[model samples]
Structures are given as C-alpha cells and as structure tokens.
Target: QCQGGYDEGAGGLLVSFYHLVKLAALSDRCTAGVMPPGEAPEEVRIKVFLERDGDLTIPTLYGLFRGADWQERETFDMYGIQFAGHPHPKRLLMPEDWKGFPMRKDYVQPDFYEMQDAY
Candidate 1:
C-alpha cells in the first residue's frame, strides 16, 4: 500500500487521502501472462472534512504508510491541515516561518514576501 495521491479538496476546505494498494501488479503483468483468480488488489479512497474555521487536524498515516510522510507535509504546507503524530510536521513547499496557507479559500496572498531582502 502507498499514498497514491493527495490534494486540497472541497474548494480548499478539505483534504483528501487516496491510497493505492499492491502496486506490484504492474511488475507482475510484465513477467506473468495474467493475474490468476482474485489476486488483484483494490484501491481505496477516504475523505475527511474539517471545520473551515476550526482546527484542521487529522491522524497521520505515516506510521502505517511511510509514503504518506511527504504527502501529509505537503497538505499541511499548502492547506494548513495538521497531521497529528507526524514525525516531522514541517512545511514541504513553504518556508518554516511562512504565514498563512496559500491554498486555503480564506487566504489572501501578500503583495510582497515578508522575508525577502532588499535588493
């Protein structure tokens, strides 16, 4: 199983989790003729919506799926979705001290970078 995809959902008010299982099928098909019986793995999707004006927090999948580490961080970075129990819960795309989630519906982009140095 792996974190196949993640993105801001519900018009930037939600965070979705798309999990993919048994990615080995691609390799198996390359070497084998056909998958026998019901050995094929099924993909699962789970969506969790949080209050737009409340704490946006959810349990981290990093413990079960190592592939979720970066994805979760990206969600936190871009959507301000907090991942509880994340080993390294830091920004993946934004600076450590950056303010506001740029992808959030209520976010207002600043006219200038606060941390930018004068030329």
Candidate 2:
C-alpha cells in the first residue's frame, strides 16, 4: 500500500524510481502527486515503480485523478504498464493486440536493429 495518496496524486523516489512504482498485493509502496502552487496539468506525472520488481502490474489512479485515464492508457500502450482498476485499459497509441511494449528499456524493435546496422 502507498504511504500517502493525498497530495493531488503521487510523490518522491524510493530505490531511484521517481515515478515508476510497481505494487504487489503483499508489498508496500507509496505514490502521490504534487506541483508548485500553480503548475499546469501537463506537468503532472504518475510515478510507478523503481524498476526493481520483476512484475510490473499496478493499480490505476484514474478514480482519484481523471487525467490519468489517457496517460495511463498511453503508458500501457507503449510501456506495457498495467493499471489494475483503470476504467478503460485500452491502447491509445497502438492498435489493439499489438505485440510487446515499445517504451520499456528492454524492448528491441527488429526494424530498429536493421536500421542501426544499415547505418
């Protein structure tokens, strides 16, 4: 469970994962949202895991932060990040049934590799 979920939506780092927090049913992780007194909504970012856990599943904050709906969807589409209670856990930028998460650090595109070799 998060230590706090009251500051708009999420907060700081643990193990150096500023916003990539992953939670287990039996694990404890915290998440929150903050900004300067007058920051724009676009400045808000939802932190997930520290990139430590092997499993990347987490609960969605769409209920508390409506803005998260689209951002979560996009993250899911590109990074394979799963939000457990998301209202619509659909792909925003990729076709439905797309293979693999492209934004994850480990992802490797065949075309990219070929292009790199050509260069």
Candidate 3:
C-alpha cells in the first residue's frame, strides 16, 4: 500500500513524497483489527527532489507497484513531474493539450477566454 504520493513546491525545488507499506508483514492481522505486540508493518518513506529549471524526472515505481500508474500520471499532470519509463505517461486529470502544470507553485492560471478552444 502507498499513501501521500504527491508532489509539492518546496522553496526552489519540486519534491515528491511517497509512503509505502509491505502488506504481507501485517496482512495476517489486518482483518482482526488488532496488532499483537512487536508486530509492525514494514514501511518506507521516499522523497524525490528535482530542480525547478532542470529535468523533473524520477524512476517509475509502476513496475513494482502496479497501482501507481494513475498516481504517477496525476503527479505528472499536476506538478509536471515526469516518471521515467512509465508505460503511459499521459495526463490523468487534465486535457492532453493543457498548458502548464496546474499544481506548481509558480503556475499562473490562464484566462478562460484563452482556453476556450483547447478542449
């Protein structure tokens, strides 16, 4: 399982954060609603930082986590963070021809009249 898989503009850099959990370690007791002492799910936190002016790319985790397909694409669409080797690195929440990433801190919203024909 993964949580908090998103990007943010931090200072002059774009940072992406992901929290991953190894379900196998805690699967047996997940449904029981109780975790015995000394039993903890294996977890990892990953952070990828990219330059604002340089290439904003990171290795795709889709190969390891199949569910990450849309997450990566959304990140790309919103923050312009490219996931290298992603099978379908297309927009998930925006139009194919949309201009500029919407979630970047420096992003300037375009005028509605300017986007009338972009659809």
How do all models score by TM-score? 0.72, 0.50, 0.80
Among these predicted structures, which one has the highest TM-score?
3
Model 1, range 1-119, lDDT digits (tens) per residue? 44322334444446546566656665665446566676665566677766666788888888788889898888888777888999999998998878887777667888887776656
Ranking by TM-score: 3, 1, 2
lDDT of 2 by residue, 1-119 (tens): 12111111122211211233333311322224433454333222344443423555677777765767777777667666667998898898876756776655555665532222333
lDDT of 3 by residue, 7-91 (tens): 3454577877778888777777576777887778888988887887899888988999888888888888888888899999999
**Per-residue error (Å), model 3, residue 77:** 0.2
Ranking by lDDT: 3, 1, 2
Quote the positional error of residue 52 for candidate 2 in Å.
7.1
The whole-model lDDT of each prediction reads 0.72, 0.51, 0.78
Question: Poorest 10 consecutive residues of model 3 by lDDT?
Answer: 2-11
The RMSD of every model to the true structure, in order and in angstroms, is: 4.3, 13.4, 2.9
By lDDT, is 2 or 3 better? Answer: 3
